[model samples]
Target: MSAPVIAIDAMGGDFGPHCIVPASLACLAEIPSLHLALVGQTPLIEKLIDRQPGVDRARLQIVHASEVVAMSDRPAQALRGKPDASMRVALEMVRQGRAQACVSAGNTGALMALSRYVLKTLPGIDRPAMMAALPTRAGSCHLLDLGANVDCNAEHLYQFAVMGSVAAETLGVRRPRVALLNVGTEEIKGNQQVKLAASLLRQAPGLNFIGFIEGDGVYRGDADVVVCDGFVGNILLKSSEGLAEMVAEKIRDLFSRNLASRLLGAVALPLLRSLREELKPATHNGASFLGLQGVVVKSHGGAAEDAFQSAIRRALVEIHENLPQRLHGRLEDLLL
Candidate 1:
C-alpha cells in the first residue's frame, strides 16, 4: 500500500509553525511510511523546515496559503472572508484527494463551518459531529457532538449515537455499548429530547443501546460511546478539563507545603508521574469530525508539540481504517 498523506495547517495553532513544523518532522521520523503536506505561508514553513538538520524533504512538501483563520474569528467570517486560510487549504487537500486526512489546531468553529461547506456530510448524515476519546476508569470512552450542533433534535441525537458507535467499532470495540448522557440514569429523568432519542435508540437495529448514562458514568466507562448534544457535551468536557487541572495544582501545592511533606512527595514522585502520564489530556489531543465525507481531526488551539503530534496520530489511525468509508457503509444498514 502507498503511504498515507496528511495535510497540516502549519499556521493554525497558537504557536503556529514553531511547534507544528517540529512536530511534523518528529512524526515523519517516527512513521517511515507517512507523507506530509505543510499548508501555510510558503516562506515561513520553508524557514522552519530549514532550521532542522536532516529533515527528509522528499516526504514533506509546502502548500502556500495566503491568509490565516484567527482564533477569535467567527465561523461565518472565516467561511466568507478567508478563502485562502491555512485551515481551508488543508481541508481542500482532503477534498481533492491530495491527502488522506487533514489535521488542524485552528479555530474550531471555523473549522466546522468550512468543513461542512467544502466536504459536505456523508449520505444520511445531517451534520458532522465532533467526537473525542476521554480517559475513563475502565479504559476510555468516546463522546460526540462536542460543540458542533448546540441545538439538536431527537433525530440528531440518534444520528450521533449511530455515528459514535461506528467510530468506537473502528477503534477496535466489538458491538460498542451505546448510552445517552443524561442528568440521571432513570428513564423518567432528562428532557423530552433525551427521552425521545432513547426511544429511537432502543428500537434501532444492531445497536447495543445500553440505556441512560449520567455525567459521572462517562468517566466510569459505563458505555463505550456516550451521545449528547453539543451544548451539554462541550460543558462536560470543559468542566472535566478544569477539574483535572485543579487536582493537579492541589497535588503540587500539597507537596511544596513543608520540608517533611516535600520528602514524602519525593518518595511518591514516580507514582504521581505515572498517573499524570496515564491521564494527561495531551495523550488524547485529537477530536474527529465524525460524519464528514472526508477525515478531519481538530487539535486544541493551544496544543504544544507533543499534543499536536497526538492529533496527527489520530488522523493517521482514521486514514488507515478508511473511517469515512466505514461510516458511510454502516449508515446504510444502521440508519436507512
Candidate 2:
C-alpha cells in the first residue's frame, strides 16, 4: 500500500518551528512508510531540515505559507482573512486530496471551523467533536465532545457517544461502556442539555450507556466512553492535564528535598517512572476531531517533540483503518 500523506501544520504550537522540525524527524524515523507535507514558511522548515545530517529531503515536503492564525485571534476572522495561513493551507491539502489527514496545534476554534467548512461533516453527524484518549487502569478511554460543540443538543451528545464508541472499537474495546458526564449520577441532576442527552443515550440503540459519570468518576475508571458538551469537555480536558502536571511536579519536588529524600526517591524511581509513563501527557496527544467528513487530528498547542510525534502516529493509524469511512457508517445523522 502507498504511504499515507500527513499535512503537518508547522506554525501552530508555542515552540513552532523547533518542535515541528524535531517531531517531524522523529515521526519519520518511527514510521518509515509515512509521508509528510510540512505546512509553514518554506525557508524556516528548510533550515530545520538541513540541520539534520543526510536526511532524505524527498520524504519530507513543504507547503509555503506566509500567514498564521494566532491562538488568541478570533476563529472565523483569522481563518477567513489568512487564506495563506499554515493551518488553513494544511487543511486545504485534505480538501484537494493532496493529503489524507491534517495535524495542527494552532487555534482550536479556527482549526475546527476550517475543518468543518472544508471537509464538511459526515452524514448523521451534526457537528464535529474533539475526541481524546485518556489513561486509565483498563487502558486509554475515549472521551468525546472535548470542546468542539459547546452548545450541543441531545442528539449531538448521543451521536458523539456513538462515534466515540466506534473509535474505542478501533482501539480493541468490545462493547465499550458509555457514560454521560453530569454533576450527579442521577438522571435529572445536570442542566437541560445533560438531562436530555442522558435520556436519549439511555434509549439509544446499539450503545452501552452506563449512565451518569462524574468528575471523580473519570479518575476512578468509571466508564469507557465519557460524553459531555464541548464546554464541559474542554474544561475537563484542561483540568485533567493540569492535574497530571501538578502531580508530577509534586513528586519531583519530594525527590529534591534533601540527600536522604533523594536516596529514597532513587529507590522509588522505578515506580515513579511507571506512574509518569502512565500519566505521560504525550501518550494521549492527538485529539480526533470526530464527525468531520475526513479525520483531522489536533495536537496540543504546547506539545513538544514527543507529543507531536504521537499525533503523527495517530494520523497514520487512522488512515490505515479508514476511520473516516467507518465513522460515517456509524453516525448517519451527520449526512442529514
Candidate 3:
C-alpha cells in the first residue's frame, strides 16, 4: 500500500500549532512514509516548522486556512460563518481526496457538523457517531455515539450497534459481544428507548448481541461494544474521566502523608506508574467520527503533544485499514 497522507488542523486546539506542530513532526520522524499537511495561517505554521531542526520538508507541507473555529463557537456558526476555518479545510481535504484522513483537536460540535456537511454519511447511515476505544478490564472496548446524536430512536440505536460491531471487528475483535447501555442488565429495567433498542439488537442477524449492560459493566469489560445515545454515552465518558483523575490524586495524597508513607510510595512507584499509563486518558485520546464517507479523527481540545500524536496515529490506522470502505461494505450486507 502507498503511504497515507493526513491533514492536520494545526490551529484547532487550545495550544494550536505549538502542540500540533511537534506532534506532527514527531509522527513524521517515526514513520518515514507518513505525510502531513498542516492547515492554519501559512506564515505561523511555516515559522514553527522552521524552528524544528532536521524536518523532512518534502513530507510536510502547509495548507493555509485563514480562519479558525473557536471552541466556544456553536455548530451552526462554525458551519456557516467560518468558510476558511482550519477544521473545515482539513475535512475538505479528505472529501476532495487530497488526504487519506483528517485529524483535528477542534470544537467537537463544529467538527461533527462540518464533517457531516463536507463528507456526508455512507449509504444507510442516517448520521455519523463518535467512537473511541476506552480502557477496560478485558483489555479495552469500543464505545459509540459519544456525543453525536443526543436524541435517538430505536432504529438509530440499532444502526449504532451495527456500526460499532463492524468498527470493533475491523480493530481486531472476533465477532465482538455487543450490548446496550441501560439502567440495569435486566430486560425490564431501562426506559422505553433502551428497551426498544434492545429488542432491535436481539433480532440483528449474526450480531453477537449480549443483552443490556449497566454503566458499571462497561469498565468491567462485560461487552466489547457498548451502544448508547449521545447524551448517555457522553455523560458516562466524562464521569469516568473525572472519577479516574480524582482517584489518582487521592492516591498521591495518601502517599505523601508522612516519611513512612513516602518510603512505601517509593517502593510502589513503578507499579503505580504502570497503572497510570494504562488508565490515562491521553493514551486513548483519539475518537473516530464513524459513518462519514471519509476518515476523521478528533483529538481532545486540550491534548498535549503525545496525546495529539495518538489522534494522528488513530487516523493513520484507519487509513491503512480503509475504514470507510470497510463500513460501506458491511452496511450493504447488514443494513440494506
Candidate 4:
C-alpha cells in the first residue's frame, strides 16, 4: 500500500517554514513511507526547500495558501476572515481525502474550531476533546479534554474517558486504567459535576475505571488515562509545562553556582542530559483533537524543529492505527 500523506500547515506556527521545512525533511529521512504536503505560501516554502539540499521532491509538495491565521486571531474571526488560511486549507485536504492526517502548530482555538467544522465528530461523540500523553513514572499516561470542550457535562467526561482509553490502547496500553481528575481520591470529594462523572465512569462498560486521581497522581502514573473538563485540563496542562521549565532552570542554576558545582555538573552531564531529554515538553509536544472524523495533531505554536517533528510523528501514529475508526467502534461497543 502507498504511504499515508500528511498535510501540514507550514505557515501556521510562530516561526513558520523556518522550523517546519527542516522538520519535514528530518521526518522524511527517517520514515521511508511518508509523503508530505507543506501547505502555505508557495514562494516561502520553495525558498526553504531550495536552501535544504537533497529533499525528495517526489514525496514532498508545496500547496499554496494565500492567507495565514495569526496567533493572535480569535477563533471566530479566523473562521470568518481567513478562508484561504494554511490551517483551513490543510483541513480541506483531509476532508477531500488528499491526506490521511493534518498537523498544525497554529492558534489552538482556531485549529480546534476549523477541525470540528471540517471533520465533524464521530457518530457517538457529541463534542470533541483534546488529549495528549504526559511522561509518568510508568512511562506515559494519556490525559484528555486538554482544552477542547471547556464546559463539559458528566456524559461528556464519561465519553472523554472512553476516548482516552482508546488512545492509550493505541499507544500500546492494554486495558488502560481510566480515572477522573479530582481534588481527592474519595468518591464524594469533588464538585457535583465531577462526583456525577465518577459515578458514570464506574458504571461505564469496557472501561477499566479507577476511582479518582489527584493532580500529583497524574505524574505518579496512578491511571493510564485521566479525564477532566477542558477548563481544568487546560489549567493542568499549562501548570505542568510551567513547572517543567522552572525545574530545568533551577537545575542549570544549581550546576553553574560555583567551581565545585561546575565540576559535579561535568561529572553528572550524561545523566542530566538523559533526564532533560525525558522531561522536555518538546518530546511530547503534539495534542490530538480526539473524537473528530479525521486525525489532527496540534503542535505548540512556539515549537522548534524537533518539537514540530514530534507532532508530525504523532499524526503518523494516529493515521497508522486508524484512530478515528477504532474510537468509533469502541464508543459503539461501550454504549451497547
Candidate 5:
C-alpha cells in the first residue's frame, strides 16, 4: 500500500533550499509512494526540482507561500503579519487534508505558536509541549517543554506526563516510567508548583509515576520521562546541548595535537565512531509539537541533509503509527 503524503516547509531553516531540497529528495527516494506538497515559493522549489537527476517530478507539488517567518521574529507578530508564510502554508495543507503531516526546520517558537492558534489542543490538554528525546549515557530519555510554554503550572506538568506516557506507549515501551523534574526526590522538597504537581501525579491513575527526578536524575538514567515546564526544560535542554558540544570539541582538540594524538585517533577510529553514534543529536532530528490534531515535526535550525532526511522518515513512521488516534484514545486517562 502507498504511504500517506506529507507537506514540507521548504523555506524554513538556516540553510533553506540547500538543506530542504536534498532532504526532500532523500525522503522521496526512501519512502515509496510518498507524496510531498512543497510549501514555499513555487518557482524556487521548481528550480531545485528541475536540477535533480532522474527525479519523479510528479510526486511533488508546489504550494506557493508569500512570506517567510524569520527565526528572530516574535511568534504572535509573525503569525499576524505572515499569514502566507511557508510554515503556515504547510500547516494549512495538513488542515485541508492535502497532507498527512507537516515538517519544518524553521522558527520553532513560531511553529509551536501557530500550531496552537491554527490546530488548537485536544480536550484536557491546555498547553502543548515541545517534547524531545535526549541521548543519554544509558540510552535516550524523553524531555518535555523544551522551549514552548515557558511558565507552566503543576497541572500542566501532570498533563505532560500523560501525553509523554502515551508517547512512550507508541514508542513500544510498556508501563512507561514517569518522573517530575525537581530539586529533590522528596514529595514536598520542591517549590509550591512542583510540590502540588508531585501530589497530583502520585494520585494520577494509569500513569506509571516514579516520583520526583532532579537534574542529576537525567544523567543518572533513573526515569523514562523527564517532566518540567518550558522555562526549566529549555534551560536543561540547552545545558545538555552545550555540554555535548563541549565534549565533542574537547575530543577533537585531543585528537588534533601533533603526531602522537593523530596516531591514537587513527587507532581508535571505530571506537570513536561508536561513541559519536551514541552521542549524535541529529540521530533523531525531528521532535513533535505534541497535542496538535495532527503530527507536526520541527527540525533543528542548522540541520544537515542527513538530519532532515531522518526527520522526514520519522514523520512517516509517526503518520503510519496513527499516533494521534491512539493518543486520543489515551487522553481521558492522561487527564488525571
Candidate 6:
C-alpha cells in the first residue's frame, strides 16, 4: 500500500506557513511513510521550505491556493467568496481522494462549513459535531459539538452521543461509557432539550449511557464520552483551557518568588515539567469534525509549531483507523 498523504492548509492559521512548515518537517521525520501536501500560496510556502536544508522534498508537495479565508471572515462569506482559499483547497484534496485527511489551524466556522460542503455528512448524520480529545483523570475523554451545532435539538444531541461513542471506541475504548453534560446528575435536571436527549440515550439499545455529568465532574474521569450542544461544549472547552493556563502561570509565579523557592524549583523541575506538559493545550490541540464522510482535523488557530504537529498526528490516527468509514458503519448499525 502507498503511504498515507495528509493535505494541510498551509496559509490558514495565525502564524501561517511559518509554524506549519516546521511542523511538517517534524512529522515527516517522525513518521517515515507519511506524505504531506501543503496547500497555500506557493511563494510563502516555498520560502519556509527553503529554510529547511537537506529535507526530503519528495514526501512533501505544495498545492497553490491563491486566496485565504481570514479568521475574521464569516463562514458564509468565506464559503461564497474565497473559492480558492487554502482551507477550501485542502478539503478539495480530500474530496478528490488525493489525501487521506486534511488538517487546518484555520477559522473553525469556515473549516466546518467548507468540509460539510465538500465532503458532505455521513449517511444517517444530520450534521457533523466538532469532536475533540479532552484531558481527564482516566486518561482522556471524547467531547462532541465543541462548537458546530449551537442550536442543537434532542435528536442532534443524540446523534452526537452516538458519534462520540464510536469515536471513543476508535480511540481504543471498547463499549465506552457515555454521559450527557448537565447541571446535575438527576434526570430532572437541565433544560428540556438535554432532558429529552438523556431519555433518548437511555433508550438507545447497546448504548452504555452512564447518566448525567456536571461541569465539575467532567475532568474527574467520570465517563469516556461527554455529549453536549456546541454552545455549552465550546464554553467548557475554552474555560478549561483558560483555567489551565492560569494555574500553570500561577505555579511559575510561585516557583520564581524567592531564592529559596527557586532552589526548590530546581529540585522539583522534572516533576514540574511533567505537570506542565499535562496541562498545556498544545498537547491536545486537534479537534475532529466527526460524522463527516472525510477526515478533517481543526487545529487551534494560534497553535505553535509543536501544536500543529500534534494536529497532524491526530489526523494520522483517524486516517489509519479509517475512522469515517468505521463511524459510518457504526451509525448504520445503531441508527438504521
After TM-score superposition, what is the CA distance of residue 84 in candidate 4 from its true location, in Å? 0.4
Off by over 4 Å in 4: none
**Strongest candidate by lDDT:** 1
RMSD of each: 1.2, 2.0, 1.3, 1.4, 1.8, 1.4
The sequence of per-residue lDDT tens digits that candidate 4 reaches over residues 12-129 is 8888889888898889888888999999999988988888888898899789999999999999988898899999999999999999899999999999999988899998889899
Candidate 2, residues 208-248, lDDT tens digits: the string is 88999898787677898899898998888777777887888
lDDT of 2: 0.83
Clash list (residue pairs), candidate 2: 123-334, 123-335, 124-332, 124-333, 124-334, 124-335, 125-333, 125-334
lDDT of 1 at 157: 98
lDDT of 4 at 147: 84
Clashing pairs in 4: none
**lDDT per prediction?**
0.91, 0.83, 0.90, 0.89, 0.82, 0.89
Pick out the ten consecutive residues of candidate 4 with the lowest summed lDDT: 276-285
Model 6 regions lying over 4 Å from their true place: none
Question: What digit string (tens of lDDT, one per residue) describes model 5 on residues 91-202?
Answer: 9888887888999998999998888887778777888888778776667788897878888888988888888878767766678889999888876688888888888888
- As a whole number from 0 to 100, the lDDT of residue 139 in candidate 4 is 80
Ranking by lDDT: 1, 3, 6, 4, 2, 5
TM-scores vs. true structure, each candidate: 0.97, 0.93, 0.97, 0.96, 0.94, 0.96
Comparing 4 with 5 on TM-score, the higher-scoring candidate is 4
Task: List model 6 lDDT by residue over 1-336, tens digit each.
Answer: 478899999987898888888898889888888999999999998988888887788999999999999999999989999999999999999999999999999999999999999999998999999988787887878888899989999999999999999888887898999999999998789999999999889889888999999987888989989999999998988888788888777887888899999888778776777766666553457889999989999998988888888899889989989999989988888788
Q: Number of backbone collisions per candidate, in order? A: 0, 8, 0, 0, 0, 0
List, residue by residue over 1-47, the lDDT tens digit for candidate 1: 58889999999878888989999999998889899999999998888
